[model samples]
Target: MVSRSRTRPITGVLVSLTAAGLLAGCVPGTSGAGSSNSAGKDTVVTDPAAMGKVTLNVLDTFSGGTDNAWMTSVVNAFEKKYPNITINRTSMAWGDAMAALPLKLKSHNPPDIVPPNNGWQSMGTLVRGGLLLNLDNYADAYGWKKSFPQSILSEHQFSTDGKQMGTGSVFGTPVARASLIEVYYNRSLLKQIGAKVPTTYAEFDSALAKAKSAGITPITLGNADQNGVTQPLFSLTDAFGAQSKISDFIYSKGDTGIAQTGFPKAVSTFKQWSDKGYLTKDYAGLASADAAQSFVNGKGLFHFDYSGSLPLKAGQSKGFGSFVLPRDDGGKPVTTASAAANLSISSKTKHADAAAAFLNFAAGEQAAELAVEHGTMPLLHANVKATGGDPLFADDVAIAQSISTNGTAVPFLDWATPTLYQTINTTMQSMLAGKSTEKAVVTAAGKDATAYAKTLGN
Candidate 1:
């Protein structure tokens, strides 16, 4: 069972789904054809028998029973419509999924669909190795371009020439949308300390100081996963106006980037918080599993985590509220989003049409409703009202939609850059360990950024 911090209660627990019953039949003219033109144009399936009884090997990063249930529901829906296809789903942890994907691809029983959140960086090696099918041709013919926004579509595309990483061909379908880092607070602790929610960086710092003075730990951080640390740093970087610079340098090789300014500030700020005792004393060794538990047990005042933690929060404590991490210079909250567990089809699949049909259904509106019912934010436009799992989930969704509508929010940096996320996460771990100085970390990252920019032909 997942535990959460109670000092500042959030809302809800993560729920998963497993397979159930089948539903309906497919709409006509949605299947892929066997052959294509020189430009890889029309996707025609000459043999309907070739698509028969197709079993799609699906890889997921969800290990919980609730997640299995939700996935099973989705898979059952797809199978019902196709009737000829079966999804053999395999679930694992995020780390296991990352480490095993390459090895699995080398084996004969490689999965037809894989979920990777790091975007091109995670899938780049596969694309370069020619293991993935270029979905550009199929996407064009299927009219998927009109289905989602360009920015959303670009998340799955990659560039071999390095000029544009998420350009050209599609490789995955986003399942859920999530904000970068929403600050979760313990309402009881805040009230006990007579502290109010902060709206700006200065106010946030003040609140931290107040919490500290009241003998309450300001923040409970779990860096054992590493992502727990870097996620917050990325949010701060975006708030400080450095995300675009780092992103441009990493993905497009733009010259006027924020690597020199925003990134360093973010690193230094995190270090400063550590120095000021805003973070837990053993944060570097803290695991997310225990960190949330500690918070639920009323050990800390605030925590930084994904909006997906809403359900977990609710199951942990009774009173929890969420806020966007306050931005510096009075800027509005600028969230970072990634395709939360995208689905991709294998190029070697014999049932390309069935696979495409499944993906199309998954990306459509009906799937969004299922996702909402399962406690996940849908990638598609939906009118579902919040169930109030975590008050923060609603706040996060509002903030995300506002930023997206105003063009202030961008996709997650890791999703935008190729292989840069691992570097950043590693650097954050080193910095947190006190093995590397902030300057050293930033300088190293800057160099890597420069090299990456060069690769992009800037």
Candidate 2:
């Protein structure tokens, strides 16, 4: 995801550090629903009246930006209607939220709802540990399968031991659709240089060289957060190779592992750009500063990031334009996309029906409109119009539509394994430090991947 530098440092620390602090709390025990008579097991309450005066605890990482307001409104409305049901809200920095989630769920009391970022990374762990409720029966009964798009539905559903874990289980609901790795260019800069936008790898390289000749940083990449740094590399990898190859590397799906194919090529391309000075020298230490600011401030020629940054750029600067990252051969541009922020229910929640109703409303048309009004692109239905200050939002919507309709997009790599995201972030930081080789990074990644896969019994 892309955004201005306003994200608090505390949030970043929380996301990165919470994992270690919370892992110890995950022990098997009966939830709060258990009764005094049922000494060892949780009480099963199927009837709505049986679960009275419930308070649904919601934990989310949307501390800043439009999403924060949007979610607040939704929760407030849900509470107003169900007067007896209260929503206890807890907001944290994204990093902290991600880190603290697993530990919190393992505690004696866990939130009924969690808005995990688009991926299976943290959610996968919960599913594996049986912390999340299976929403399949509820989803089927409520006709959610018909209401949600296939891509969105597929993300929540997973298979374990050849049995589907979360897909039909209704464990989660998507909040928005996320776009990863689009190319944002400063139109004024391109016009000043009299350069045409590049549509192929060779042309892209030439464009970068031209920008450098004009004394402008060709690309604005902030790697201070490892995920920020890796996004551009992942985008470039998709541009240079086939989508299937990228997927194999990300998922570690084949017999030879992800390294034997285009994985090395992707690394080599990143190294080449770094060696040639296409990326800034201080990129490794750069945090998630506003990518649009770098380009709008004339510090860089182009910025690569999610569609979420569109409004920030339009509001903050003028003469900005964006495109789907061009393909290697210039045939078509492909991107990575997924259900943006999904809502999931805890397996231990007593008011399962009420919780499901709230999520259904959250994912429905009304909530989608709220997302569009807040400058977020909606994944459910494309008919809703954007209402933010960003004029370039239409272009972003078009690019997203093109990719969704004609291109091959996949989920983010970090989504596959529980620890792969942290490992990748650490490895990328090491590479940027000049202390790690591409081969070494890949090897370390493979070790981590193997260990994680074993947890899944793969």
Candidate 3:
């Protein structure tokens, strides 16, 4: 599948559903979901009314909480501007979306726009199955190549056989551009520990020591789902040297390995934090959401997570600050994992022109602003000032721009394989519980990394 910097406007309609709960829903109607207008796939039609009235069906994982509200807000404006098109949405919580999408793509009624998921199994599976459309036509038609940077667009491409990305077929346009990992700190907690946003590892370690001395949880981590540990691991890996190989390994490229690349510091950092009393006691038992909540609730000094984690405002999150974690050896900012949030059309979409038009509009400046309004940063290059209700939005935009300038954002470690997330989580769980050695964690993950290569037939 191809990757491009595409904008996303989506949400869960209901907040109650779990990822498992998402499985019971029927597949969305695929009956020519992208049904064509007479102008054909190559047609250029910008006016919604001129393209004729149509209802675009979207199935996505944004069904609950802020995601649902944020998406509704974006669509509200989009519909007002183009009175001819209506969006019929199917929502699932992120887990549900992740669980449900593989099956959804197999349907005769597959959605025109696939709900976005970054897993190799979910995205890579579809690309390999030939289920997603090759969006080169739309890319050319919309001048999307010029709209998004090549770095952002690279991951969306997949070889026809689905064995490669970064140079091949273009699949989807991405949006909600972001840094894969950022250290979000609770403002009050930082002040209590006498900490400033650390630009170097030494400063960060010093902050941790101070926070621990103050009897505050220096960091809060929830690993119940087995995925949370990877971010810190990623952050550690980013600071390690020759970090370009980290991305290379993630992309299944030339002789690169995660364990060899960044595993040592990742384990060392975790061990140091645990021994320093910097980690929340019994953190392995908590969920990522729970840990994030605790940090926001003032139980911790820092929460290492993404920009999209907890929404922060002047009154909320007890005052907040965020910064991209710096490497122990800084030269290029190491982005352990980041990608264009890919949004693609189905090959069977008959409404290619209309679908492409919607994508085109989503890729523009207005949606970029709308993204900021909803607490997600846009992937575009345009200047959209943060409204100041939340400063994190503005901070994230600067981070995203830094990523764009640097010309690379690596994939999350979990992208190495469907199993990698589980491995990292379980390994961290073992380490936190004092049941496994750090060397063992690295050894186990490296084995899986090799297995992932075999699975990819690379």
Candidate 4:
């Protein structure tokens, strides 16, 4: 169980994917051959077996406990499934890989396969530089559109101009579908305090107050690391706004999307909760994992964390139960955040057919079972049955289904800008510490978004 996609470092230079029609690059014929489409320019592979001997260099960075272990099993299974292909794999920690991946993708010898790191920094860089294989033809060839929902596949698509996301040619697929923000509560504490699980933000706020007045930490936060703060912040923001409007802003649909939006309201609520003594005051010195462990130890009443930590909750006290954060207005069930890390193919790969085959298998039923066995949510269309024996896994599946059905999955706030993760995390910490005001925090994020949008040529 883990978090996040990436945050971009500052670059004084900008690259353009639209400036030149990049499909005509040095890789192959304008229309691909082996896996080329019927038009003869696009790649088309009807059979991975026909591709013969192949070696795919895969660069994967999902390096954590459950995800890392499950990926290992998936790699073994995939290689076994395709005996003709060998996977030359190199795995790294998330941050280290993010720092090194862009340079590597731009290098002469790039990994044949790569994991999807969402946002402008990783995918956008590759897309803009024309270093990515447009997966449009392959999606049709592989029947991916029939298997994956548009809600999940939207994140993978980018226009050739790189001006839009969520619509256009398919880029790649992620390992599974999961939530980024959720309310994990100590059920015993709720029982002791005589508070029911909240279905709306008002009831939730009341529970937090009740917990605080009862001398329990209402919320356990680990802001010392700065990164984890976005989970709750994102949930709180989405709770106040319409999912569609907020999504447009997230997708950079319009200029004033955030100018008059729900973010400020969420910030105010966060600061107010801190002021009311409902949250830990020492969060600035805490690590997210340590904070989560604190919740598992039953030291805190409520902990907002990524669903990736759900299995970890299984090891904790037996009284833990989780819910996606409730909406402020009791509107439709809306998901504040979902999967960030995904899968992508390299433009330099020689075994496009085998690589595509590996990706298809990765998103298939076996991988779904692997996800469930590791205590993670499967894809929206995945056919998963068990829940890795964690009691909370069912509740997680319910929430994931809820979003897939009635609501939409929004991207995390950090994906809004290259450096916005650092900006928002730092600001949230100061705001929680009472050193920064709500206006300041919102202003910082808005400025980053505006500046980044210009760089994106929007």
TM-score of each: 0.78, 0.79, 0.83, 0.87
Model 4, 1-458: lDDT tens digits are 45442333323211322233322221223232112212123657757677789888988876767667778888888878778888888888765665666557656788888874676655665565555677777788878787665656666777666666656777777665564577888889988889988888888989988898889899988776675577777788778877766766766876655645588898888878777888776777888778887887777888887765643533652467778777888886566655545777777666677777888877777876777776667655434554545556677666766655553677665666567777877787777767878889889988888887886678
Cα TM-score of candidate 3: 0.83
State which candidate, 1 or 4, has the greater lDDT: 4
Decreasing lDDT order of the candidates = 4, 3, 2, 1
Which residue ranges in model 2 land beyond 4 Å of their true spot? 1-26, 30-55, 76-86, 107-109, 117-120, 143-149, 160-170, 177-179, 196-203, 224-227, 244-256, 285-292, 309-315, 329-332, 403-408, 429-436
Q: How close is candidate 1 to the true structure, as a TM-score?
A: 0.78
lDDT of 1 at 160: 43
Show the colliding residue pairs in model 4.
31-41, 32-41, 35-43, 35-44, 36-42, 36-43, 36-44, 37-42, 116-342
Consecutive 10-residue window with the lowest summed lDDT within model 3: 1-10
Regions of candidate 3 where Cα sits further than 4 Å from its true position: 1-50, 177-179, 225-227, 241-243, 311-314, 336-341
Total residue pair clashes for candidate 2: 13
lDDT digits (tens) for residues 427-451 of candidate 2: 7677767888888767876787677
The Cα local distance difference test for each model comes to 0.60, 0.62, 0.64, 0.69
* lDDT for residue 394 in candidate 3, whole number 0-100: 62
**Candidate 4: lDDT of 303?**
88
**lDDT per residue (tens digit) for residues 189-271 in model 3:** 77777777788888988988888888888888887766467667677777774556776776777887766577677787778
Q: If both were scored by lDDT, which would come out higher, candidate 2 or candidate 4?
A: 4
- Candidate 1 lDDT tens digits, 138-227: 576567776665556666676543245556667666664433456778888888877688888888888888999998999887877654
